[model samples]
Target chain A: MNQQVLIQAHQRIQPFIHNTPVLTSRLLDEIAGAHVYFKCENFQKMGAFKMRGASNAILSLTQEERQKGVVTHSSGNFAQAVALAANQLGVKSYIVMPKNAPQVKKDAVRAYGGEIIESESTPIDREEMADKIRIETGATFLHPSNQDEVIYGNATAAMELLQEHPDLDYLMAPVGGGGLIAGTALAAHYFGNNCKVIGGEPSQADDAFRSLQSGKIEFNDSVNTVADGLRTNLGDRNFPIIQQHVERIILVDEDEIIQAMKLIWERLKIIIEPSCAVPFAALIKERDNFKNKNIGIILSGGNVDVKNLPF
Target chain B: MNQQVLIQAHQRIQPFIHNTPVLTSRLLDEIAGAHVYFKCENFQKMGAFKMRGASNAILSLTQEERQKGVVTHSSGNFAQAVALAANQLGVKSYIVMPKNAPQVKKDAVRAYGGEIIESESTPIDREEMADKIRIETGATFLHPSNQDEVIYGNATAAMELLQEHPDLDYLMAPVGGGGLIAGTALAAHYFGNNCKVIGGEPSQADDAFRSLQSGKIEFNDSVNTVADGLRTNLGDRNFPIIQQHVERIILVDEDEIIQAMKLIWERLKIIIEPSCAVPFAALIKERDNFKNKNIGIILSGGNVDVKNLPF
Candidate 1:
């Protein structure tokens, strides 16, 4: 929870990332009995908040390091973010994605000039493939969540959120590998000590919640959730940081997340993927926790395959 | 044609309507051989550009008239827009919608506090039903189009586009009742005389194209486009304005529109209804016309039912 690191990340990523708007939802406010402000990172570059961290991490690399290229294992938003950022910086990107990853995401990575190496769905398999690519290409491996720079970069989203609404009583975000929530909590703690930071996790993949309860990192053998972004277990690096600043981790069922996704799409007219809907799900399912308070929720991404929307 | 009316409409609607960002695509830019700036009114309030017209028309009524409430005949965006606008203004809204309209839109209207009066699909039946409601409730009839105020309000979208990108070499927008195009053309003519204003229409409902060519209003017995928003024939008021400023009307087939809709959703991660895909259809199908030029296209709406996406 180093304040200077978050500040440095903010300064590093500010030029590349969009200062996405903080949208107020009158309907959500009424429903939650709180003034709900949505920090719309869903509208960020590469269509997700991952772009902030990816861009920051990519841009921070030295010219010599960049010439060697970068590698990462992501089957979703972070893959596209890293691909696009590396493309912008004129560096090659090697994306190690699951064999079952959506064609749309693979196509996006290719469109952004990232070379993809598909691997088995398991984390070990993907990491092994990424390691092979890194060793062969002499590229730096940028972990989606475990890296310090990535977490620091992800914190800028909360920096922007708190800067826009300083009096926010609660800050909530969806937790996957815990990069976003860990970064968000660190930034909020740095900016406002009194503000409670909450993590919204899918009930089907509630590793973060269980990990928090047990005071240890936890893993799920198989994740089953419509929110594809929250399937990953909290990383070792992110778990410790999150444990320090996060007030609580609330679990929302897949059905509730789907309902929240529809509510946001119908009312806000914003196309957010199920992952981004987790926080809204938490708010809707746990309204009493946020009642009469100024709450800020981060809409993490909008990269859902329209053809495969979980209606 | 009336500068003062346009100015007044711009002033009245400026505060309510979102000046949604013009998103550009590097990939599309290379493919189209031009810089394409998408004016995303799909992100506008009520998920459509209809909000500008509906909000301005509702707010323009005299306080006494507003006290009496407002009425409109629309089964689509206008129904939701008018309902939401009236609700915002604390005015009762009576919406005459076709019984066959999608439940999602009907739900949206209801959610916005509109009282739905179901009617037959025919324009005559809709108009009669709206009129009866207006007469019974003494409510001001806010025409979806074919009204001076509504057309003026629609023009503000183009005004904002021109202000944001003054050097736009070509402007294209979908033509339904010609409300958006008429307004856009008026703004383009005033702000960028050299700019070519093209109306994009569904080939199945090419009434606007036919009307522009024949110098008279035209009608289609049964529109057969998936673009529900562009099924209507050009309104009497809008047809004349469009005929004056529009350089050409490009007719896009339903399949092209669907493909464009998919491209926007998959590429840009924006949820746009089929009608809003017309301009992109024009770009994809008639790239030769806009190659290497600075083009501005309006994304008319994003209110499509997620379950009902043509894909």
Candidate 2:
């Protein structure tokens, strides 16, 4: 929760993660009416910012704990993140997924040395199976987002961005489980030159936006957004950080997300997922609010199915 | 082309173009069975390597010629390249695009300050219109791929790659208008540590491969290839250079091009045009020929229409 913890976490995970580049486009800058700097975590190892948190969590474990391995339940980027990080650190990883998960997703996890434990097509089923694995094998149960070490680890991305462009007026990131944005808020508070942190979320899954307004954790009744990454609810650990540090959560519609994503793909020549485009969509919606200012955007990941692109 | 011209071209275009990054992938290395280095011209200004040649051609113009401006006929990356380069040099650019050319492409040219002069949907019509503009305005007619200055300019890409990794055993590039590969061969000849240059081409549009074998300029009977950029025939200015310096031309089918492209998109997390994938396709096809060797591959461009992705 403090700057020292975040700093140490960054140092610990430094050797394992890439200090990904900050890219700028003149045309993009013109369209947004701001000097936009893109922190490209899409180019990170395992192709997301999740690698930082996973590496930090796995490395923080003791030799005996590492020998017993780690277990997590997710069908998204975190699965690959933990698998790759654990493999690199010479530790075993047990990934629990629903039986209906895509073959490609399961293959990717296995490719990174994850032992898959399939369960019924439900969250409770996944969690119970992961817990059973942890109890039976004495493996550490690592939460994908709602963990202190993971949040601190995720802060390193904004830390690197602030180090490169300290004069940024605002730092924008897409809110998934609030891990990346909470860490970003911490980074901006400690290292930025009076920079404010902002979060972007889909209106269809606007739990983070309502949570900020109500000053409490909120959950969507039904998730109907194309941003598959942002469909998860904010966690207890990250929700408190979000309430205290995050400035505001902006809501964008599905069309705007697709438009912003297309612009990045066409103008910046980079592949970014729908969740990554949420922040840029917010920028476009409120261009007048931040016109001519310097902004840093976290391109969260680039792990989309290319064959099923919306635009 | 000689070393001195390439060296001087690099110096002349240094301020105008980007010294694009060279990226490496461990997984990609394992798949190709070679230590692969990719020179990312996809990240270059105008999102293609054509900018290098365009800038060189425009910068090489005399003062009077600069006052008169420059003209070219095409609807591909070259149109945008010449427009952007001329705009940067403060010279007028007249772009003759076909009437049936895609609206997105024409808009790109105009966005770069090109004066669009539409002609009938035929190569001869475009050339005639460009020739008419040249006569009317006394503007210099710059061929997209057949000119000496442009070829020398394109060579700077391989020059940079060699400078960064001089011990490369082989250099590979996709053959389009023959500008990039001809220049790459010359660069390897002059700056490399005895590096052999190889060319990749589609069998559907195998003019360069046939031209190299037949000892003369040859044309494809029907240019039925998805690699839209490599459909042009080799020209007089570049054929001799290619013949003398290039080690071999490898032909790949359409399926191979798409497969290689998907692999790059999925693994490298970068968007590249189909033409750019031809070289990697060649490398993948001849994996045994390149195993355990250090090879440098030029990723030609990243200007694909996202809506029409073949994958």
Candidate 3:
């Protein structure tokens, strides 16, 4: 919402999340021909940046609200993030996951003490299940990427990165449901000394890229990218901020995403999900434009199935 | 070498290498039943702890020796380390690699500014090529693990670990050509309040284990382990120190190594070579022996070919 709100959110989640380290590789810098600082959220508590937003959102609640518990619909990292955050904050959490979700995902949610409410594989089914639980149990429903508090919480990562390297010329993040890039945009605008924000999206699922040009939320024509995380449409809550503050959204093809992801894994020596590599791929794709600038890239997550590597 | 020597080596190489971060996972701690501190040498320059030793060994050489440059026979992380370290320190380095070494590996060496001399795929032929280079150019021949300075430099990883986590009850590493474990044993003895050193070795490449029992260097009957880095036999210089200071060596079967390596890759979200997982595998095998104690594990390297993962 504002600088003060973002700062307060960071302080609130400080006790629960990691101020994950910023790593730089000379080889990676040389490859891109730019000074690249990787804010490694892959090392975040749940192996993703969602932990920051989840912790802040849950922590921002009143005692009475927290007592009633919180609910979310996700079959991805957000499910684990909310579960772990609630478990850490001594609050009950209910996760509405698709019945056909990966068993490992189900196990992780259960391991974090969250009760899983199964739904059909459709988005409408998942949302209905979450809404039903919220009504029946008087639980608060948390959106993965659309809420103000969650966006502010996600802003803290870019805030911390700016604090460490104040001279960054551009800050970039992968465009998913738009929370991370939207939050990152707000952070860059508020805290960065003229540091602009950019977004990276899969060409197959380039709704975020499309929404910026059309000035409204847009749906993907096909959600078929290897970056499973970036297939979602932008949220109303995050779209305006993205439109007002984000400099541009770069589109990378599936081959580019896999190639960049492999390069990060090999050169940075850190595992990252395909979605996380989108921004880096964009950087590599447009290397000449950003040849000598100080760039900060947020590696959004590392929660990938290593057994099924794209490369 | 003693405390001051290790400290000096660390100081000399500090500018060239990374003081790689220490990472922990609550899940991993629960699995091992011990509070574990992972000294992430996988994040080191050239993606291995060998950088520390290679930098130190080159730095310890006299200015005249440095001008003549350094030479070594190997087709592993050490070759890259020597090249990068020498390049950074403004010294020439000649790396003798077996003719059959992977093209990617040879490219990595060349990328690091090392001159590569091809040798026959035999120990005798490799050594002869290295000797020829030394004789022709007056370059200093640096053994990958056998020499005293290299061993002392290798010890700095453990030294830094002990400095950060002085209360570690036990320090562990995978025993390869014996330099890392030997250095670790000395670091624990000198810098640790009372920390003991332990090693993990592949059961197939059980030379280190046999040498400890027979009180001499021993050759492996078969070098068929997936941990390619740990296939070498112990060196004469490091063996005596290992025998004197190392409490014991734990042998892990290949299957166990793969399982533990996957756990680390999944849980820690960090890429590591198969050899790097050996110590953690050893810890999982002997979890009961180390229950509720503070332990530190040095992740030796992260230079594995992801395309050819063991899993």
Candidate 4:
């Protein structure tokens, strides 16, 4: 990735993305045996950090490009982010989501004025449908993660985190398609190498860990985890960035993540989805690894269907 | 109330309470025909603004008073706030809650290291039970709102809000025992009387409005609102303050409060309890009255059990 592009991403997305609060918790610090500062991307626009990348990608489009409209294949936060961002820019959004996607998420996408095209469950099917839609509508396809603009946009969170806490010894975030962590790593490296960047993945979907070990992008045949947000494999563009800047990848079990989620809700009174709890789970599972460190944890999202709480 | 005591309350609870984010929605603004700034006390410590009073009351206690422990009768946010604040201060807490209180709230009180003393449903029965416990254990009974210290603590949120936006044209908050609105009125008056302070009450439990109108405290025979936090009548100490400072009391139907709760959750992605949504309900119901005004609305709490959403 060009350094200029990342810098441009920071400048372009500055006005669009919220500089979300960095919250410190004495209770969380005691539990983690470290001073932990949470960069609350869960409180970001669209209720997730995905808005940073989606808004950046959408806004980066030329006037003519926006006139033709934009398309993406996502059933989750990115779908809502793209739709909302496009709506804000007065540009049409064509979203390809799986038929089985949560109704709440689908409703949110449509409410943001997106044109939804439902497809089969698989990513291949969603991508194929997106391609068909793009061909028919002459829309620009904006990949959720495997796009340079998206990675750069995701980096904004890390930039803000590091700017707030320059002496942060360790940085951790949950990994899904590796977009957020990959971008965070790039930003951490750009800011300073002293701040070690790590990715936390659910043990049920440990493709990121496997991919990092083998130094290649790995695909999961099937994924099952209560954390609906972290079920995807690393994307093509994000894998290399992760390899370059991420210190290590840790896997946390479903039980640990649920416990973390409950802890956040009960103690911190912050409602975060299971994916956002993965970093806290990683800390609890590997306490010795982060003891007494000045840690920065990115709470990825807060878009949970309250009715279906695992607890 | 002593002038010095009010000033001291301002100093004591100012740092602990989150000036709480003032969130504005273009959609809600358009709908209300006003620029609404939501003061999110729901994000306050213990997931309620009650923490401000609880923490202040606990902190204000003499060392000898604290050594005797603290007791309070509450089945809701006050119980949890007292427990959490006392636990933080390393003081023992004795919470008297009705046996039929929500298990989630009771459990939360227990989780915060509070010793629960179950009583009958009525306030008289709970108070009798609390007095018994207070005498037997030599615990200081921290009245939820019918006390000067607690009201002062609740005032800090308003103080901060006025400081942030000095030219706020109008201020609104839900009325439950009138403590929050009373404190808010005091703060607003101390800052400036140019800003109108309106109390929002559920039509099902409009005792505050009735009490203000009749020049005497009035109690509802039965309360029936989804806003569990706003069911109580005005307190002895708080009623006078409300009569003196509150400009108008607006009553919203239960359904309006529900709709407001859903709107906050769906549009803003913030989980607010029905009680907290009352002010927004007023905004929605009385849109014409507030049109073109710079409105400040206090979202008092977010402690609703997400697993059992009313919607």
Interface RMSD values, listed in order for every candidate: 1.7, 0.7, 0.7, 2.5
Which pairs, if any, clash in model 4?
none
lDDT of 1 by residue, B88-143 (tens): 88999999999898787788899989999999988899999998988898999988
- Give candidate 2's error at residue B253 in angstroms: 0.2
lDDT of 4 by residue, A258-303 (tens): 9888877655656688899998889878889888998889998888
Q: For candidate 2, lDDT tens digit of each residue in B161-226?
A: 999999999999999789999999999999999999999999999999999889999988778988
| Candidate number that wins on DockQ, 2 or 3 | 2
Error of 1 at A132 (Å): 3.6
lDDT string for model 3 (A263-299, tens) is 9999888899999999999999999999889999999
lDDT of 1: 0.87
Question: What tier of docking accuracy does candidate 4 attain?
Answer: acceptable
**Cα shift from native, residue A204, model 3 (Å):** 0.5
- Could you tell me the TM-score of candidate 4? 0.90
Global Cα RMSD, each model: 2.3, 0.9, 0.9, 3.1
User: Candidate 1: where are CA atoms >4 Å away?
Assistant: A98-102, A118-121, B90-92, B99-104, B133-138
Candidate 1 collision pairs = B33-B292
User: Could you give candidate 1's per-residue lDDT for residues A183-294 as a string of tens digits?
Assistant: 8898888896489999999889999999999999888766899988888888889999888999998999889999999888866767788999899889888898677998
Give the candidate order by descending DockQ.
Answer: 2, 3, 1, 4
Compute DockQ for each candidate against the true complex.
Answer: 0.55, 0.84, 0.83, 0.36
What tens-digit string does per-residue lDDT give for candidate 4 at B11-66?
A: 87666566677777777788789998888887787788899999899889999999
lDDT for B115 in candidate 1 is 94
Expressed as tens digits, the lDDT of each residue in A62-107 for candidate 2 is: 9999999999999999999999999999999999999999999999
